[model samples]
Target: MKNLRNALLLKQLYQLKQLGYKYTSVTPYKEDEQHLRLPNTLDSLKKQAMECHLCELSKSRQKVVFGEGDPQADILFIGEGPGTMEDSSGKPFVGRSGELLTKMIENVLLISRSEVYITNIVKCRPPNNATPTPTQAHTCQPYLLKQIELIRPKIIVTLGVTAYHYLTGDDTEISKVRGTLHKQNDYTVIPTYHPSYLLRNPSAKKEVFEDLLKVKELMGK
Candidate 1:
């Protein structure tokens, strides 16, 4: 009986390992109960996200990047996930990619970075900055959804393939869809290459520039 119990325990642990969990904890409430407990307001929600432990990403993350910028902004920029600098500083888009994004906003859009909101699909950084697993993204989806509800931006610009995929549920290649506008309920979602991608392939800057032009035009009406 003892050996059988030990084998079962190992099986459970192995299952968790396969799911990308580095740690686990017992919670007092069910998943729905915990989710229902989340506050509605942005500030209150941010505080809750700071203390979030819904998934294993929380174990490795240095901080939970809730989001930043004008809550009432007409535009919201969504990225795939956090990176090294973001994890350390708890701010989205803060390194070279961040600088490029800032430039895009200021130069192309003719607005300051603070005029728009920025965040990631997943609040926490994945291990070694790997793409967030589906489970992790699913765990964080409610938070992002609530943020969208509160912010209610007129436009949502997805910064990469991952952001575009998760937000719109469209598996279309970003190259094929980039710069195209898709209506999501009330808001207009514009798919674009991430700033990080531009950093590696500077040639794509022109393409993103055109996309931003479309966003700017849409903002006018």
Candidate 2:
């Protein structure tokens, strides 16, 4: 009974924290500082995201892979979606590819996982790690947009084609998209290679690193 009470109390606290009650920053599932307003906060917002059973990927998912990072972060990195590693771990990009991301983030921004916010276009892991469908993006785009509104990031880094297509509505190849900045609403969106792609084609890391350098310049960090 005590455990149940404590869990309820914690949920209440989280809701309170979400409603502009807290001023400090905090990470989603880690020990870091981030602003309190994020898309996963409002019950209506979460319900909208959770009600999405529009994709086949929803069947196999253990949890909806909503994003994580500083709500008030100056930068945001959007990827394809959770993989086997992220699905099992319930954390974004914590695999061999994640190591490359950590190195790139550190080399570029001088921060660890807890520093920047990370998330995906689709929260659930697609079976066999296939790409998320167009319908999935349609269903999830509003939530992503809401997140952007809540966070208000200055720079948005789209990791590879999946993210690019969702944010920019351009299905063109990533090679053409890399390093170009597109203004959406109030944010500047930058496209780049995903760490997993860099893992497959090591030579592309240089390009990804170069694109990330632009993010560093924007952040001034």
Candidate 3:
């Protein structure tokens, strides 16, 4: 019976994804009230995130890079995990790649960096900037889901392969999925290369810009 129920929920989630209705959970927060008190505000959520130790990453992390930007923004930018700069600053997207991302938001989306929320799949930085293991992602996913629930952004731009994989549950390469508009549950998810990748490749900046243009168009709609 439990297995069957799980399967049905998964089916419904997939259907919602197809229909473009992005949200955190099919069941309301009330169902899990005993386990967690879902915060109605981003600040409260950040407080919870700062103390989280659900995974091993927490042990080595200097600080939890909770995320930043407008709590009520219409867009959310999710990346994989934090690197050295992010870990040190206890913020997301404050490094070189972050600077590039800022430019992307300003130049293409025509919005200030503060207009959209920015976060990562994991709150803590993985050691030496390695990819987060599935266990780590699974443990931290609830926090992100709750963030999505609270903010309820109209559009979510996933900024790399890891972010795309975590959000969409799709294992395809970013190259194939980039610039595509996918429906999660209420948000339209647009995947693109991480700014760090663009820094290395340089050539891919054009494609990232194109993806941002699509994001701008979607926002206007």
User: Each prediction's TM-score against the native?
Assistant: 0.86, 0.76, 0.84
What Cα-based lDDT does every candidate model obtain? 0.87, 0.74, 0.84
Sorted by TM-score (best first), the order is: 1, 3, 2
Q: What clash count goes with each model?
A: 0, 5, 4
Q: Which candidate is the best by TM-score?
A: 1
Model 2 lDDT-worst window of ten: 28-37
Candidate 1: tens digits of C-alpha lDDT, residues 44-139: 989988998867888999988889999998999999999999999999999999999999999999999999999999999999889877767767
Report model 3's TM-score to 2 decimal places. 0.84
| Candidate 3 C-alpha lDDT tens digits along 1-221 | 12223323544565566789888656721233344554667888788789877568889999999889898889999999999989999989887899999999998898899999999998899998999877677667777888888889999999999999988899999999999999989999999999989899999999999998999888883
Our model 3 lands, by Cα RMSD against the true structure, at 8.3
lDDT of 3: 0.84
Give me the candidate number with maximum lDDT: 1
**Candidate with the larger lDDT of 1 and 3:** 1
